[model samples]
Every structure is written in C-alpha cells, then in structure tokens.
Target: MSGVLVIAEHRQGELREATLEALGAALELAPQTGRQVVTAVLADDPQALAGPLMGRTHGLRLMAHPDLTAFNPEMYLPVLEDAIAAAEPGLILMPHSSQGMDLAPALAGRLGLPLVTDCIGLTYQDGALTAQRQVYGGKVSETLVLKPASMYVCTLQGGAFEAPETSAVDTAGEEITLTELSPAHARRFVEYVAGALEDVDIAAADILVSVGRGIGGPENVPLAEELADALGATVSCSRPVADVGWLPKSRQVGTSGKTVRPKVYLALGISGAFQHQAGMKNSGTIIAVNKDPRAPIFAVAHYGLVADLFEVLPKLKDKLAG
Candidate 1:
C-alpha cells in the first residue's frame, strides 16, 4: 500500500465540509503509518472542486462524468474502483454522510474488504486497523479490529475530527485524469428534495441553549429561548422535546439529529441521555443544569449545577443582563 485514499464528497456542484474532516483524519494517520495521502474528487466538472483542495494531498484523482451531477451508487462505484486501483491504498475513508452510508457498504462488499461505519477514532498499527465507536447509545465505547485485507474501508463520523486548514501543507495535489470509463447503472440521479425550512442552524451556532423533558412542558420552552436570546445563543432541544412537538425536529439533537460542535453548549433542564450526548459532546465547553446530580449530562460537562433550572435560569439570566 503506497498511501491512504480519501474519497471526497460533493453535492450540487459544491464540496461538503465532511470531506475536509475526512481529509484531516487521513493527514493525521499518514505520518504515523509512514504513508502518503491521496484524495479523489468525482464530479461532473472536477476542475471546479480543485481550488479548495489543492496542495493538501500527495495526489489528486478527478473522475469526470455527466451522470455524476448527483451521487448515485451505480454511477460512483466504477470510478471509485478505478481510483482505488490506481492509488493502491491501505485504507479508504469517507465521511459518514448520506452518500457515504449509501456507497461504502456496497463498495466494500464488491471488493471484499472489511468495513466499519461511524468510526470516531482510528489507528493503523503494523498494517492492522482498529476503529473506535460509541455503542449502547454512547454509554460505552467499542473498538473493532478487522481481519487483514489488501485495503480497508470506513465511513467516519462527522464533528469527530477538525477540518484541515487551507494552507496546512505545500504539496500541491496534481490532478489525474480518468478516461475511457464505462460506468454501471442501476440507480439514476434524482433531484434533491430540501427539507422543511429550518429557523435556526444549531450546527453553526457558537453557543447553544438546549432543553429537554425536564423543562416541564412546551410553555417553558420559551424560558430556554429567552436565555438563548440573552446569551446570543441558539435554542435547541433533546429528542423528547421535538418528539412531543415542543420544538421542530430540526432543533433536535441526538443520534438521529444534527451533530453540532459549538463553542459553548449550555444544557438546561436536560438529563443528558447518551443519545443526546452524541450530538453535542464535542462542544468546547459544556455547562449543564439539572436537579438530578446523577444526570448523565454531567459526565461530559465542564461545569455542573445540581439545582432547579427554573430558579437558576432566571437568576443566571439576570446576572448576564446586569
């Protein structure tokens, strides 16, 4: 194996942030394993995606095809196979997004390579691959050791690794041409349907004030929102809050919801279930308030207050106002 191959993901003619996060993981592992890093970007117009990715990888492979306007397993698999053959990578990684989820398992099965999904941490030692992932709803972690193969495939979790800086390395990635390609066809590219308009993008927020069932009921959601307004933070909620129609599903955070890495995550009246923790545990600072001292949220919080959020939130809001 000459290097690690990172499959760059794009949609609607633009690169995804998760691709950068996957690249960052590849770069981190390259030095330790003494292997180079290569990135493959497949697009209808591969040139348009090169600007942001230049000088970052040991090599760049661009596969262009008209049918690649959007990601489909049938169209991408052939080009990906060619890229892997050319790169001869020991490991292949992509972000665990919708596309990755759709493509990785089939690709690994076709190539007879072991596969891991939603891996948060990775180690390549003596050519053996070990992956770390949260299990039992993030209450416990499990490590997987795969049987040896020529190459390994994995879809990594987003928000687990930092995206690489634009000017981190000087090795300008030279683009490789994919020619005379005949792709397989089973699924066709379809129009992307945008979800309901979200009022707040909690994933991009600098700070988040989130509530849960402990907030009492839908009426008290405004209290959390008021605190968020005072702190200039966005209001988010646990799955239960959204399930009960207290908040929109877009504002919910958990395994089934958006992953966020805010600068500060203030969990108010939230018991901090493992599922909820999966979404915001990566926040820079975690301050949790719950009447239950044994709330699981405190395990990941930098600061914990074992008091009634109703009383504390009002006083804290006043403190901030003053």
Candidate 2:
C-alpha cells in the first residue's frame, strides 16, 4: 500500500493550525489507501514541531536543513522534493499558505507530478482520491482526480478540516529520524522586512468588523471605526474599499486578500460577495448589517440585520457603551 505524506508548516518555532488540518485530511486519506499516514516536518529545528504530532496516530518524519531556517523557494523546495523522493508516498498534502503556494507548484514542476491547489475537501472514490476546490472565487466548486502517478501534491484550504485530539500514548517517546539534504544550489535569507500595515492580520484578532462599499465613502469609515471601538473589534474592509485607498490592502478581506477565521466577524455596510465571503466564512459567528436584504452576505451570516449601517451602528454602539 502506498503511504500518505502530510507536510508540517511552522514559522518562528510555532506550528500553524493548517498543519493539523492537513493531518486530519491525511488521516482520512490513509484508511482509504490502506496505508499508514506519514507526516514530514521541513524546518531548521525539527524538535520545535514535536508538540503538534506528539499524539498523532500516523508515522512522523522530520526533514531538517540549515537553509530552511526561513522560507526560501530555492532551498526549501529541493529539500522537500528530496524528502518526497525518499518517502515515495502516494499523496503529499500541504497547507494552502503563501509558502505552500510558492513551493507546491515548483515541486510539481520539478517532479512532473499532478498538483491540486486550494483543496477544500477530499474524498476517495472508486480507488482514486477526488479533491474539491473552489472556482471563480468560491462561486462554484470543482472536483479533480489525478491520473496515476508515483506521488501527488495538494494544498489543503485552511479551516476545511478540524484539528484532531492527541492522545497521551501518541505523544509518548515516539521520535522519527531526521534527514538532512545537501543542495548544490541554496537560497539564503538575509533580512526580514515587515509590512507597514502589520496590524492588519485579522485572523489573529478575536473580533473583526469589516466594511464594504455600502459604507459610501472614506469619510464614513470613522463611523465604522466607532462601532468597532465600542465592540472592541479591529476594523477591516472589502476589496473595493481597499482598492479605492479608503483602507490599506492589508486590511482587505477576500479571495485576493487575507483569509481570516476570527472568533466574531461583524460585516458592516458590506454586501457579501463570494470573494469576500470566502475569506471570513469560517469565522465562528458572523453578523452582517446591510441595508439591502437581498445582499448575498446574509446567506452565510449567523445573524443578519437588514437596515442602514449608519443608523444601526450608532444605536448598537450606544447600547453597548451603556
């Protein structure tokens, strides 16, 4: 039986939730393939990723390299490519992060393998794995099946799979051997530059209040900020608002921008376009305030308010303040 390989994603000694999600998908794929799931962590420090896989059911491997200290395509891709060759797994799963987007395609090109990017769901059908992916900015979903290959590469969408619980026995004294790769050509990381709008990571925020074109103009953003302040939430905006320079691109929420899964997402004066919804649909509780009752944002929203945000926001803010 061919094994399934899950790539662990981490940065600065912290494992990404998407890695666990990928593991969940790997677990499901393993039984169908009748093989054990194997997880591989590619990093400078393999020990840092031990916590997430401590209680995992499948086999784990660590691929460590000095060049992998920071994400660089030239260095990390070759190491991962070598790992895949060594493991000889049937399927390779990775998170659909910026790093994954860069590496998955390059790896696929290097190995001449079929690659499926941004998969939201996976299922086994007739001895083949079918992956579901969003098309046209989440307006439609397409299922893809790869031709028979030694190995397949796929990037799993974030929040598509829930993290599984780790058992005490799973974390006990189990350690996988670490493999080192010596690449003829390596990319070196020199310096890191932070984005000017670094505070715009809505995914890390507990509360997010996002605005759309319905807010009318840039001047009206203060009103939205007021409501956000009252609710103790960070302010975000849709693509249009950000494109028009009303807000920075970092604050944009859509398929072209950031995908955030905040605890509470408040959509103010925003018409929920499919692109925008894709970013925040995974949020815990979505509350949309739009004057148009026909706005598509209400479809996925847990709570909907059909009224002008200008009027609704002030009342809600005052009530909260009181």
Residue 152 of candidate 1: its Cα lDDT?
A: 91
Error of 2 at 146 (Å): 3.4
Q: Pick the candidate with the highest lDDT.
A: 1
* Model 1: worst 10 consecutive residues (lDDT sum): 172-181
Give RMSD to native, each candidate. Answer: 4.2, 4.6
Q: Estimate each model's TM-score.
A: 0.78, 0.77
Q: What is the overall TM-score of model 1 with all chains considered together?
A: 0.78
Cα lDDT, model 1, residue 193: 75
Q: Residues 1-322, candidate 2, lDDT per residue (tens digit)?
A: 3778787888777887778888888887777787777777777777777777876646777766666677777766666776677768888888888778987898888888888988888876555667898775455569888665667889988767877777622532333344555554656668866555656577688999899998899999998888788778899989999889998888988776888999999998887766688799989999999887878788889999999888987898889989
lDDT by residue (1-322, candidate 1, tens digit) is 4578988899888898888899889988888668888888887888798777766666777777676768888778888897888778999999988889988998998888889998999988776889999765455779998776668999998777778887767654555555545656566656887657898798999999999888989889889889899989999999999999999999988777888899999998888776688788989999999898877789889999999989998998999989
TM-score of 2: 0.77
- Candidate closest to the true structure, highest TM-score: 1
Total clashes, candidate 2? 1
Off by over 4 Å in 2: 168-186, 195-209, 214-216, 219-234, 248-264, 269-285, 290-296, 305-322
